[model samples]
Target: MRHRAIQILFCLSVLATFAAAQTVVEGSVRDTSGNPVSGAELSLHHTPGNTVQSTHSAANGTFRFSGTEAGTYTLTAAAPGFFSSVHNFVLRPREPLALTIELQRQERVSEQVEVHATYQTIDPEKTGSSYTFTREDLERLPDPLLESSNDLVTNLMPGASDSHDNFLAIRGTEFSLHEFINGVSFLDNAQPQFNPGVSPQIFETVDLMTGGFTPEYGNRFGGVLDITTRSGADLGGHGDVNFRGATLDNYDINADYGGQAGALGYYLFVDGFTSGRYLDPPEPRELYDFGKGARAAAQLDWKWGSKDAVKLLLMGGGTSFQQPNITDDQLVGRDAQRHLRQETGILTWLHTFSSETLLATSVYARDGSDRVLPTTDPITPYSFASRAPFTLGVKSDLSRYWHGHFFKAGMDLVRLRELESFFFDSRGDPDVFPAFSGGLKGGQASFYVQDHFSPLPNLTADLGARYDYFDFIDTAVQLSPRVGLAYHIKKTKSVIHAAYNRYFSPPPIEYSLLASFIGHNAVDPSQRVGDVRAYTQNYFEAGWAQELRPQISLELNAYLHTGHNSFENHEISISRIFVPINFHTARSNGAELVLNLKQWDRLGITGRFQYAVARTYFYGPITGGFAGDEPLAAGERIIPAFDQTHTGTAQ
Candidate 1:
């Protein structure tokens, strides 16, 4: 009887151990249309232990995991051409759990779906403030192709307004915003005064980041406009042509073609427009404002095997316009013509080492030239100026997911060359402007690393650092650190976020070099041309977002920026050539409220409101070009002329 009892106890212990290790998790992947999806990558993450196990679905779209420990886990499924799906659940000992993951087809191109997924999931993890216009939102515009991209920004984005000559100002900061097309910077494309007016037809999405961005973004202080061009993936073949004629002798023509063959895809877009009222005129009756321009852009994508892909982009555009004239100038028969040209080429390669790791590298070149013809009015003849700027750069980024943490690192190296000329034709009068010509060569290097992770179930944190080196007329180096935090209150359906960021922005290349040249030449004895330095700032932000209903959401955010060497621009004595200037100290504070109502019964609405104040004290000694003699009064706070205290928009 004793032997039997011992045997029974041992058997019972063995059975219990076996049962604890028998936890089975199984899942099937399917599309929204109820069709099975094979070869989908799936990952199972143990929340408490921070362990991850990955697998792929079989031919029948079924996957299984045995011997999983009982705990809280997150399961994620990702596949090509589909939106990723995530599921969270608790596993119990000796219990078999079955799950069905339904993925939604991505309507747009598939080239950057993985990259897009990272951003789509950022709302819960990001502490920054941003606004996005998706393809669907853009399609709703009555004339997407006809409307200027700047108009969309000024009309819809809070704290954004049009500055002098179609330039954009955010939070009273002029010439501080940066523009990117398909992840490539276009900073040197054309002079700062001209807007390329890229056709909206080629845009897949537009994202505007106002403040509190990560270290991956640098060299800009006010804002960043990130645009993703459209692709032809999954589209067999399609084309569109549009033409419109309106009053004021204005007309526009746009055409686009896209298709996919085998593993390669291509998209092409071309547009031309002529407008009688291109530039805002000083008088009610527009005169000498006629303008015409043409643009062409193409994208090619190729994918091979399962781990590698390549993309090529080419773009070129040219614009010729008559500078608008004031009533007095019109009466004097004064007319000026401006011509602008820009071209860009980029090649990018992507490789995926595993389900949790991705790498991307790109090599790009951009060239731009701007010329303002000399006016022959004789009475108020203006000098002619031209600038040709070229840029070549290489950028690489690596992304990895490990142990519930998302990590990213990247580096950028850029070479810059600029050529500039000015012809005044003073006609032997020294009082008139003298002719001058010069060029500059420089380079910049930047590196950054960041990690995003959840320390608790409801709290997420992002920590990063950046290093930058600039070698131009002067050498400057900076190291910046960034931190962000987000906390979710599930019961209240709200999220509270905060961020602290240090920013370093180098001066604009063309303007900085021009300032150096002017100082060396010293056309005027009284002109005090000081050295231009990189701008530095400390930014702080806090925000709260709440979901009122399934389709309704609201967000309120406040930000403060304290910086030195704030950037400003001044026109060169009515010549329309802008030069960079700076302030000794600058401070900006603002609050914004945004309300979004998703498509409910086919009706969607978005509303935004902002209140801001921007002030600067003491003009920097580095005033350049036309502003060489700007007064430098110490400790005098001056409100920026472009500051708009209150702005509201609804759509």
Candidate 2:
């Protein structure tokens, strides 16, 4: 009886071992003629445990490492009368992977063998109109003067207007360009005031999503610019310094350093510039406008292991500009001066459990202050005194990915505080004008999820949705849904894509808070109105990309933007007070055509053409009562501000 009981216990232990979950690495060995190579020996070694699993390919050229644990591994395959080969692969829990190994007949037995690992592209699964430029492309620009700052954006993107300096208008929308550095956004109210920005040389790549963006992005309705800074990889150390000089007594200096030490890596970039008046002056003078600024950014990264990392990023900058308000080609003592200073920082932690699973978390903060002294009013003559429009904010985001699905959710909490002391009297009392002082504190929280799936050989689909809640002038909540599909033609290397997205954005805190000052401190009610909430837009896009030749390609895209709850500020009687209103139903339709040519014997060319028509129908107290117009004659439909019919660029 004792012997029989021991036998039963041993049998149970054997069955349990086989029933447990295990990692399986399976593959086949083939010859140059695609014939199965039998009697092939394979060895797999786990990196962490240092354990080895061996197998032999069957006559059908099939082999597998079954019942093995999950870990990083090295696999070596050897067959008689063939060159030995090695491959490195990883296995995650409950995930099985397959591979194919091709072996060539050996001319001579050698000890040296080069092992190559498979790599994949980081392109987003979603389909949209997107363009990417790497460091190599930026360095190859024909003009050195256009290599710094955000100049490349205007030069390359269709529907981008360069009529104004350092400003871009995309798809008929002005003041709606949102910028993100390493997945963290720089918020803008009504204008692009995020100043003292980084130099382009400090970035590794710049990605622009023109339209039909996914739910992972928010806070902007027009476009998205995603900038990725350079990183110090496993390479020991590297750095570069660049300097340029141009006409009009303009000069710039840029320097950067990157290196890796043990488990830590670091990168730093510094830029400075000084320029004599470059823009054509409204009126000729000794000096019309000149400015200078300096910016610096640094990052430190620590690698906990092959799959986990932590990074710290810090940046700060300041700018000062002087403009002599000239009249009749003569200097005026009432010169205008403006100063801006900004600082930003972020800390991030990232971990990868397998090839298909990842988690990332980041916390960030920003502080900026703007001081403007406009030309003194001829009447008040007291410099029209007002000062210090300061901004500060803190935010955080969490990202997770599993298989082919991605998710991101975060909150952007901000505080906008300002002192409106612009009033000044002829008596020069400095406080003669009623002073209005206050601040606006609010934030937005959002959640989004996206999935990428391939249901057919040449077709892909992506679906996502986002929900947002804003705590501001008027409490509001919104839900947006986005979807895209792409089809590839393998024979021609072409792609057809279509996308639809619903987008929502709230007015800037500074702009939304102005509603409170309507009747406060003797303020005139005729100058302002109230009621602010989030803006919503619907985007539809379709595009086709074709490779005409080995070095050339062409793309054409068409899009329509239909939106309501548009934010517009109206001046009742040309007074300083502007009432904010969501007064327009806006519609814009556009098409873009782009041609690209790769470097052929030292020269590359790119050209783009765009055509768009944007219109807005305003219905409110002000629009209905224009004196020169008959009531309901045109139903309040008119061309809004910054509407351009045709825009193009070439380089």
Candidate 3:
């Protein structure tokens, strides 16, 4: 492409902006092709703090950003398939800035304007690679009586579908992901899944950072899921009861764990859900849940000494979904259909080293042994698995106007292990079916460095990288790098953002399938993913942002990704090894749009849409055999099953 930009500003009148006042800015966005881009974004920025106040874009290739301050600022226009453009102007005291911004053909994308949607905006200056979830987001809106935190993960950015029961797949890696318990990796392995929060009501925030984080984080090609519990706004003890008619009935009560003595703080929370069967007069069979769900948690904090502070969190829950299953011979329930039980726990601590350096560590453990527990055949009815991982790390950050440059450094170590067991069904053609199972253990350590360079007031850039080591595989050393930049449109409110990040992902389980044939009455059945070897993923995205007004703005982003040695979740059988031989790769492309309205407080609205295709072919020899209408046709691909023809959310 070529270096190009187009900035158009339509001010209703230059004299009207004499008195500073709240105003509006509305305009149209077109391209060199003389075609109007309907979803193009318009952004307006106020001076100082640069807080994102609003966002919006209308149909007919037109956008209106209202509630802006009457100050001399800039206006920017950006769209996925166009070049970055800006409009610099002087907003006097009153009236509105009616401007038109036209973007050129595809050109280099900038950092701030890189994301096609408003939701992609993150304060990169604060953290490099972190995914945050605002508790108020529609996805977290309190559900009637949901029991498990396992299913809540699907709503997170970069999170995958629920593959195996309770089995989570992060990025392309299935089970290698790290789940945190209040910042500490799990030490117990009894939870049904890796998502740590059991009841959303107890947590105030949930963040998941896939990679490119500071040294304080541990080793793993996957990512990290962090949970923060809410603190009691009041000091006095408080309690409340939640009573409602739904699939589950809930009741809760909590107390402040500290008093006026010394310097200590803590809060306790306990709640339980009764199955419909336990209700008065009892509920119908169709709604008769086989088990009740219960959970309890506590958050504690205190000053360890003069310059140190310590915080601790405790949480646990129990849940199961039992359904009716019958065979041809008996109408009565011959097989019990159920979602089993799991346990979880976590602990974390932190100490300060003056204002420039801080030290901290966390420990997490979880056990998921909730098996079928067949009522008739109680002995080895199903499989039982557990995982425990510990993390220790330190961080040092300096904040000063030293040459107008910022720097940071950190390092961390992680230890991981898994205990698994599997059993065979008495009716599984018992002859050929083998009763087998096994477990695996591994550990790793990693470190990283980063720096943000600001040479001029209108220009900024960031660079960083990380290295990790593993024991299970040779050449364990791995590197992850990231880069970003932003350019301010002279003195205007307009700015552009573009970034590139390189992350590593573990392959599926099939790559390790050879292990099953070598075992004697012992096997893991499948590794991390759906019985497929792990595959690595390298994603690249570019987009832009615009401050159309102080209260309304918009963003446009486009991305193309490349995947090598990709693995597919396929069938597994003896003698046949694993279905779909490994060693395959592919590519994909897509775009997204986001809108925000700050004027409407009580009513919040957001929307996102994506179109991408991922495909892979059998790596093994296929000379004479026909590829057969493409094992995965363009319109027939399912890698991203949720890649709906039309996916959306509204409230």
TM-score order, best first, reads 1, 2, 3
Candidate 2 lDDT over 260-369, as tens digits, reads: 88778899888888777633343455455677888888877676655566666677777776643346323334555666676666555555555334454445556566
- Candidate 2, residue 211: CA error in Å? 1.3
* C-alpha lDDT of all candidate models, in order: 0.68, 0.57, 0.41
For candidate 1, list the clashing residue pairs, or say none.
none
What TM-scores do the predictions have?
0.79, 0.72, 0.59
lDDT of 1 by residue, 1-651 (tens): 112322332343333211001235665899988789999999888643344468899888888764443445678899988988877554532223556688888888844554212101124544677766655557666573335666676765667766546667776566666766655665541222555656666766666677767777667767776666666663459888988888876888988898899889999989998888776654567878888889998888777786666666777788898877888778988788889877777665667666566676667777777888878888765679888777777677776666656677888888887788886654443434456788878889999998877789878788899999988767889999999898878678788999999988887665566655554555675554555667788989998888776545678888888888777775555565666766777788888787765444355554344443444333444443334545455555666666767777666
Residue 291 CA error for candidate 2 (Å)?
A: 1.7
The better-scoring model by lDDT among 1 and 3 is: 1
Candidate number with greatest TM-score: 1
The C-alpha local distance difference test score for the whole of candidate 1 amounts to 0.68
lDDT at residue 413 of model 2 (Cα atoms): 45
Q: 69-89 in candidate 3: lDDT tens per residue?
A: 333355666767676676644
Best by lDDT: 1
